[model samples]
Every structure is written in C-alpha cells, then in structure tokens.
Target: MSKYESVYIARQDFSTAQVEALNEKLNETLVGLGATVAKTEYWGLRSLTYRVKKNRKGHYTLFQIDADKDAIAEYERQMRFNEDVLRQMTVKVDAFEEEQSAILRNRDERGSRGPRRSGPRQ
Candidate 1:
C-alpha cells in the first residue's frame, strides 16, 4: 500500500465533537477497506481565503494513511458525498513524515513563546 496525506474542510457550523465524529466515520471506512490510518489531526476552525459552499470559515482535519489506490479513491468518493464537507484533497506521498503537520507545529511554537511584557524603561 502507498502512503497518502489527506485533508478535509467541514462546514463551519459544526462543533468540535461533530468534527471528531465525522473523522471517526471516515477512519472506520478506511479500516474496513483494509487501510491503515496513521494520524488524524483536527486543525481547528479557520478562516478561508474565499467562500466554499457559501461558508467563510471551516473546520480543517488532516489524515495520513497507508492504503492502496482503490482505498484512496473510495475515500475521496466518500468525502464528495458527505453533506458536511466543504472541500477535501488527498495526495500520494513517497513516505510519511514522523513530525506533526506544519499547521500544528506552528500552533505549538506560538503557545511556547512567553507572553509579551511592557512598560520597562532602562
């Protein structure tokens, strides 16, 4: 099976729990198809550069999986038929990266930075 990285944007109105459930359903589909899901990350709600399905914001979710071509095709088909999903993309990758996605890494870096201080005159 080949490695693949996939992302889907859900309608902005969905709560976090709803988003989780959607991903779980997709994961189950992959598993049922004899595919392995490596990582599933929720990137949180984010503003879109442009509207999609009349939505200005969306909940972003990422999936990294090892699966055959047929499995990946089925996954995309599922995404298209899902009413809650706004957009989805999947790409074939030579290998999976062990590190967290850049989006999550950037979030962690921002959190790790200390808060700004002010009103100090030397």
Candidate 2:
C-alpha cells in the first residue's frame, strides 16, 4: 500500500472535544475501508490566512496513513459531505517520516523558547 499525508481544518466554532470526535470518526471511516492510520495530530485552533466558509479560524488535524488510492478517495468523499470540515487535503508520499510532523515540531520549538521579553528593541 502507498503512504499518504492528510490534513483537514474543522470549523472554528467547534470545541476541542468536538474536533477530537470528528478525528475519531474519520479514523474509523478509514479503518472500515481497510486503511491503517499511522498517526493523528491535532494542531488546535489557528487563524487562517483568509476566511473560509465564513470562518476566520479553524481546528487543524493531520493523519498519516498507509492505504490504497480507493480508500483515500472514499475518505475524501466523506470529508466533502461533512459540513463541519472546512477544508481537507491528502497527498501521496513515497514514505512516511518516523518523527513528529513539522507543524507540531515548530509549535514545540516556539513553546520551549519561554516567555517573550517585554523590553523595547534597540
């Protein structure tokens, strides 16, 4: 089976718990179609570059999967019909990365830098 990286943005009005439930629902959908979801990550509510579906922000989620094209097609099809899903994308990849995804890695980096200095710039 080929590998893939899938990401989706949920409508901003939803709570974190609701986003998690959506993620679980999607995961189950893939599993039902015989796909193995390797990783699931929630990036939390983030501002979009521009508005989408009348939403200024959204809850981001990522899924790394090992599955065939048909399974992914079905997955996207399901996402297309979900009103809570603002947008979704899936990309075919040669292989899956074993470490954390860049989004999460960058988030950790920013968080580990500690609080910002309040002093004025020179």
Residue pairs that clash (backbone atoms under 3 angstroms), model 1: none
Worst-scoring 10-residue span by lDDT in model 2: 95-104
- Candidate 1 per-residue lDDT, tens place, 87-117, comes to 9999999988898899999999999999877
* RMSD of model 1 against the true structure: 2.0
Clashing pairs in 2: none
> How close is every model to the real structure, measured as TM-score?
0.92, 0.95
What Cα-based lDDT does every candidate model obtain? 0.95, 0.95
Cα error of candidate 2 at position 109, Å: 0.9
TM-score of 2: 0.95
How far residue 25's Cα lies from its native spot in candidate 2, in Å, is: 0.4
